[model samples]
Target: MTEIVIETRSGTLAGIGEAGLTRFLGIPYASAARFEAPGPVAAWQGTRAADRFGRQCPQQFGGKVRRDVLESETYGEDCLYLNVFRPEGGSVGPKPVMVWIHGGAFLAGGANAYDASRLAREGDIIVVTINYRIGVLGFVNFADALGLPAIPSNIGLRDQIAALEWVRDTIADFGGDPGKVTICGQSAGSMSVSLLMLSPRARGLFHGAVMQSGAVSLIHDRERSIRDARRYAEALKLDQSRLQRLKTMDIADLMRAQAIVGKQLKNAIPAAPWYDGDVLPASFDEAVATPTAPVPLLAGATRDEVRLFDLMPGDILPTKWDDLKGLLRDQFGPEQTARILATYPRSRKGRIALGSDLTFVMPTRHFAERHARGNPTWFYRFDYAHPLVGAAHGLDLTMFWPFSGLKMALVRGGPDKGRRAELGQRMRSHVAHFVRHGDPGDIWPRYEAESRKVRIYDLADSFAANPEAERYAAWAGRDVEPGRGK
Candidate 1:
């Protein structure tokens, strides 16, 4: 087996690797007990086996996540680890590093789904993916449980910070630059990026950030989060004094509680990462709207983000249009609804566009342009459809990382195989170049107010500075609910 050594705060750890890239997996960054506080990783002697992936945080099973990832064990309250990827042979001085934070709505997800081999090999960028605590163990604040002070809510985010500290200290030995680290994530990972921008604990961990489809609009005030916490405690059937007992409960019980709380909350409020008046201070919207912290940002969204997930049955597409019309009237009232209907019209195209625009693309561009005033911001719209998926959510990641072979299943015996493959090469090139250098190159210009430039990636033709001002303006100040794109 090929092997390499890196010195961590604990000790020197030797990680075995393969021909393509050197990957260090299951490296502990922080240690936390169930319902306890996380501080730092425990010091170890000699070396640890980082050859295998660490445990992923627990979540509800049976979904779109890969089977390889699903087969991984669930480590509740004990899921703080990061994986490092380095090219086979590289100089150590200052290689670009991209630290990835996985997204699962702050409740269910892990980092193992992403394979950084291609990014490390092709992009020549060292990639580190980390796992943080999720659900109640990571969140769900029970006030003064067992005579402790207000429990830290967003322990998951703190895990990310700890992993970055590990990266800062150890990545140099793995042929990565500690100073040139760039943090990039999609969906919940993007939300984490936005929240990290506001967190004092996360400052200086990374220099630049790329937020893809970060819908930070769905957050609650501190009072509201605390209120939700009380309800979660009630569901757990734990008295204020015996809240410590939760730590001793079975891991399955914890998962059940998480699912229950998740279902109950639904769209009421996010159960994790509250505006704790300390960790998060205020909601992300408030932080970005008022020009709080200044950080370089590249944020964007896919064109048909919602069509990928159809909550309703396919048979009801016809009758659903009537309900959509009524929803339009209820949201905007008679006159604006009429105007909206006139503007978008009632059709299959209208329905898909409205959902996709409001749910993802609009919020994405709005967050970018609004923050552009105070920070160096670049925006992109991924109109590049996968022919079948039609530019859906999480599609671009397969092209960027080129792992797990999931996206390959979307295509079959087709004469257009080589053309799609070539276009995918271009996508990887663009993303890798962006991660290595702060710019996405001449094909995608730096977004500025004077010229709301955008890079459109598609199979037919690709170009930069293509603005979606109409979509952006319509959903700019809307309430971020369903059908608000109308």
Candidate 2:
């Protein structure tokens, strides 16, 4: 391996050359204190070695040890880093850029978990993976709860905007076209991308967006945000008199408080992005009706998103019928809830369908419908089933890049492995095309209001016009308040 140096506005970075790509890891995009907006990174004197992954943002282990959690034990509060991957001698000038944001339910995820080398080389595009603050440090609205006007409401989203600003300012040096940047993410990250489309501050940073299994559905309203902050402060034993102690407290103590608050609110993420009028729209209705940034969009959800929740402990989603009913009723009320419930059968399948549609499917399709009204939008459904869990919540993730052996086996354990690999390639090709030309090629038709065509990704791919129209009809007029019930 050899070193490749690139000069940026901040300083010089030395990346390592791998098999067929050059990788620059652990590049700091911005820096921030506990609850403040991100600030510019301080310039360095000499060339900085960026050969290794950076520390993940400090987060709580949510009752279960998963793959990303085990990958690294070292984490810190100052964890605003990103990574870049570019193909070796692929194109003459700048290539289309794809920026990836990972999803951990707005709580626990990092940038180092993903390796974008293969995606970059095969697609002939530059891929950037980023990290931002999560959990209490990022999402909680301490600004209002503690009368601390200096703290920001959406620090996590601010980190994302800062990272995008860094990309816009510095990507050209890394053979990336900042003008053709496409933002892609899954779950909470996907929600961030969708929310960014509505954020005035994030307007020209991206030209395209791809959301997988998420949209702006799980965000907290202002009351919920402030209530959560109070709960967090109470868990930390910090009243207004002791508010100053929060910044100096150990990160472990904060994590423990986060975990405690998470357990208290069963079947829900304790902290999430709130509708702050500054960074985000002031109200849920305004956010929903706000015209999104004029960018081509490719968004979709898997067939059985809720099934994966059953296998995990401490379910973030409502897996039981009563819990799902309460949540929908909490937002949609009795009559609308009854209309939605009448569409499905009363069984395990019905529970999965109800929860999946309520949590992921309907919200994603709703966003696509709104986006398609003014901009180019392509919608899809991932139908490739896992041997054990069917087409689960994160099944689309495995198709995009190579994962660990255990994850691959658990998701792709059944027959037709070769065909599944081929399907993954097709999906990536569509994404690469979208990143280049702002469309996912001609084969996948645009989602229109009349037909509502959707591309279905399965062992044998096909197209459908308005699949599950009945369920969509049920959720048509309902503008349910997001993050109402646990």
Candidate 3:
């Protein structure tokens, strides 16, 4: 391994070259206070060491995060770092770039969790993974509830946008093409990509996108957002007059308050992006009706998206039939809710299907369908069932990076380990192609409303025309009205 230095708009960074890749880790892209929007990083006087990862955003210890990531990462308030991986001795010309946003249901993840080495080396592209504020510090909106005008809504999204801006102004120095950047994510990260497509501030920052296992169904509506904020304030024993004290409180104190609110909501996400009209559309209905950024999109979900959550504690998703029914009733009319519920049986399999479709699958399909109307679009479903969980959520992440033995076993186990590895390679190839050419190659056909073409990834990759048509029909016109999970 040897040390290499590259100059950027901020300063010179000393990265390392190791095993056929050049790694620049923990490069700060932006800075911000507790609730303010992200701002530019200060210019450094000398070459800053980019050999190790920066501290992650302050968050809770466990809950939905990978065990390895939870053990390895450290957290702090000033965590606005990004990592860049470039293939060693690749084309001298500028290469396509992919910016990855890690997902933890908008609360528990950091950029260090994902290593983009294989993606950069095999795809011959520069891959950038970013860290954004999560949990109460970044996501919980306090602008309106506490009468704090300076506190911005969706600071996490703002951090992501800042990272992209840094990439646009500085990536070319690392042999990356600014115009060919593709933003990609999984779960909450995927939802972030969807919202960014609809965000006016994110226009022109990315040329394409790939969403895995999530969309806009999980955002908080205005009423729910303010309600949750008030709950947090009460948990912290703060009011509008004491709101400014939030900046000076201990991180542990804030986390304890967040936990209090989480238990109160019982299964609903305590912190998530809300449609504040500044960073997002005015309301959930307006967001659905608004046209997204006219960029090529590739998005999909797993066959059994909710199964993983079923094994875990808490109803982070509506895994029970009754829970799913109540959420549907909250969103749709009595007649429409009954009609949708009648489509599924009362058995275990039926409940799993209902939870998966309503929470992740259908929302992904909705985004893809809307995007296909004008811009280029490709949709897919991961059908390679896990031995125990049957292709659960976060399974796609294993297909992209080289995970630890325990992590890989979650999705790549059973008697077909070799076959699953091959499947991962194919999926990565398609994603790289999409990032490069604004399409996932010619083999995977573009998604159109008339055809609804979808690529199914399994032991043997195949194409299907609108898989699960009945379920799609049942959810045809219904939309998730983000609110308090009553």
Candidate 3 vs. true structure, TM-score = 0.95
Candidate 2: RMSD to truth = 2.3
Task: Sort all candidates by lDDT, best to worst.
Answer: 2, 3, 1
Give the Å error, residue 75, model 2. Answer: 1.3
What lDDT tens digits, residue by residue, belong to model 2 across residues 1-486? 999999988899999997889999999999988877999999998999989988888776585323333224457776899999988886688999999999999888888878888788888899999999998889998888878887887999999999999999999999899999999999998999999999999999999999998888678888888888888888887876665688878666777777787887767787899998999998888888899999999999998998888887786777788988887788778998898999989998888888788788888999999999989999999998877788889888888777767656566653325887788788888988898889998578899999999999998899999999998999983544447522
lDDT at residue 407 of model 2 (Cα atoms): 50
lDDT of 1: 0.66
- The weakest ten consecutive residues by lDDT in model 1 span 311-320
Per candidate, the number of residue pairs that clash is 0, 1, 1
10 residues in a row with least lDDT, candidate 3: 62-71
Global lDDT scores for all candidate models: 0.66, 0.86, 0.85
Query: Top model by lDDT, which number?
Result: 2
Q: What is the lDDT of residue 266 in candidate 1?
A: 30
- Clashing residue pairs, backbone N/CA/C < 3 A, model 2: 386-390
Count of clashes in candidate 2:
1
Q: List, residue by residue over 1-486, the lDDT tens digit for candidate 3.
A: 999899988899999999889999999999888888899888999899999999888777334333233223566887999999999776678999999999998878788878889888888889999999998888887878788877888899999999999999999989899999999999999999999999999999999999998888788887888889889988898877776689888777788787778877755888989888988998878888989999999999998899988987766667777778887887786887887878888898888888898888888899889888898899999988877788889877777677766645645564225877788788888889888888889578889989888999888988999788877887875666435424
TM-score between candidate 2 and the true structure: 0.95
